[model samples]
Target: MNNNLPEKQPPEKTDWLLFPQEISRDDIEKEIKKTPIAIQKILNYYLLTDFESKYEEIHLFLKHFNENKKIPIAKINNPVIYKIIKTARSIQRQIHKLMGLLRFREIEGGYLYASFTSDFNIIGPLSLHFSRRFPEEKLIIHDTKRRKALFVEKGKLYEVVSLNTLPSDTDEESFFRQLWQRYHQNISITERENKKLQRQNIPLKFQHWLTEFKGSCALPQLDGNRENI
Candidate 1:
C-alpha cells in the first residue's frame, strides 16, 4: 500500500487492461497508450480463452493486424488468423452469457458472492464488469473450475493470492432466496412447459448453480428415445 496515493475516488468503469495494483486506467493509458476498440476485443479474447497453441495464434493475429489495418478481418484466410478469430467470437459469447447468468448472494462480512464454472478462463472480464456495476458493494466472483476468485472492495479490485471455499451465506440470505425461488415457481405456466426449448435458452450446465432450480428434482432429463423429468 502506497501512502503517497491521491485522495480522489476511483472511476466507475472497467476495461480490457487489468492492473493488479490500484493504478487507474488513465495512468495506464499514459504508459501503454489507449488501445483501439477492435484491438481491445481481441485482447479480451486472448485473456479469456485457454485454447492450446494460443501463443502461436495470438502472435500470428497481431502480426496480421499490424500489416493490414485497413482491410476487413473477415477477408483474412490464414489458418492461425481464422482460428483465433473464431475463438475470439466464442469467448465473446461466453462472456456475454455468463455475465447475465451469474447469481450473487449475500455472504459473510456482508460480501456478495457469485460462483460458476466455465470451459473458458473468463473470471477476469466478469470481475471487471460487476465491480463497475456494484461499485460500493463488496463482491467475490468465484470461478469454481479454476479455483480462483476476483475480490472487489470500494470499487477497487483485488486479485487474491489464494482462497479456500467460502463459508455459507449469511443466515438472513435464506429468506429472500426462498422468496425469489417461490416467486419463480408461482409465475410459471406448467401447462406450456417445454423442457427441451427451456434448456436450449438456459443450458443445463448453468442450472445446477441457479437458485430457482434448487430443490426441484423434476429438471428435464433425456434417455435416447425417452424423455424424463
Candidate 2:
C-alpha cells in the first residue's frame, strides 16, 4: 500500500461539502466501516495500485458514495469507482503473477532466498503468503526495486528491512540453479515458440528475477503453525 492516505489533503479549491475534513486515521476507519465488508476489501486493494492519483480517486469515490447513501456502492455507475475496481483487480493479478514466478533457492545457513522487482509496493502482501506457504521455513523475499526485504520465519512475517547484503549461495545451490535452467531450456519446443505471447505472459520488467525467464510474489492462510522466528 502507498501508506499516504492519512496525509492526503483535499484540494484548496474544492467545494467544502466534498472534502470537509483532512484525511485521518479515524476518518478512514469510520468510512471503511460504513461500507460492506467486501467493498471494504476492495478499498484496501485499491490502495495497492501504482496509480499516481490513487488517493485523489479514493477520496472522490468516498465522497460520491456518501452523498448517495440510499444506493449501494456496487450499483453506482461512477467513473472513479470503476477505476478503483479495475485497478484493484490489476493489483491482484500482479500478486498472482509473482506467486507463480518467484523461485527460491537455499542459501548459506539453509535459508531460502528469492529476489524480484515490482512497480507496486507489495512486500507486505508477499510476506503474508510465503509465511503461510512454508510455515516452518526461514526465508527472505527481496524487492530489489524498492530495496526492501521481507523475512519470514516459523510461519510468521518478520521485520522488513533494507538489506545491504544477503547470505551467500553455496556450491550446491548454484548447481541446482544451473540444473533447473538446463531442464527448462531442454523442454522448449523451438518451432512452437511464440515470443509475443511469451512476452505478454512474462513482461521484461518482471523477468529479471525469475529463474526461468531470468526472476520473480503473496499471502496464504497459516494453518495453526504460527511461531516466533
Best by TM-score: 2
Per residue, candidate 2 scores C-alpha lDDT tens digits across 67-147 of 888987778887788888877787788888998888898899889998888867777888889898999999898888878
Instruction: Write model 1 residue lDDT over 1-229, tens digit each, in one string.
Output: 8789878644643212232335443443342224467766665576566665455445456556667878776686667677767778878887898888899999888899898998799888889999899989999888889888889988788887787867677655665677678788989999999999989878899998798888642333333542231
Candidate 2: worst 10 consecutive residues by lDDT?
215-224
Best by lDDT: 2
lDDT of 2: 0.76
Q: Enumerate clash totals for all models, in the order shown.
A: 0, 9
lDDT of each: 0.73, 0.76
TM-score of every candidate relative to the true structure: 0.73, 0.77
Residue pairs clashing, model 1: none
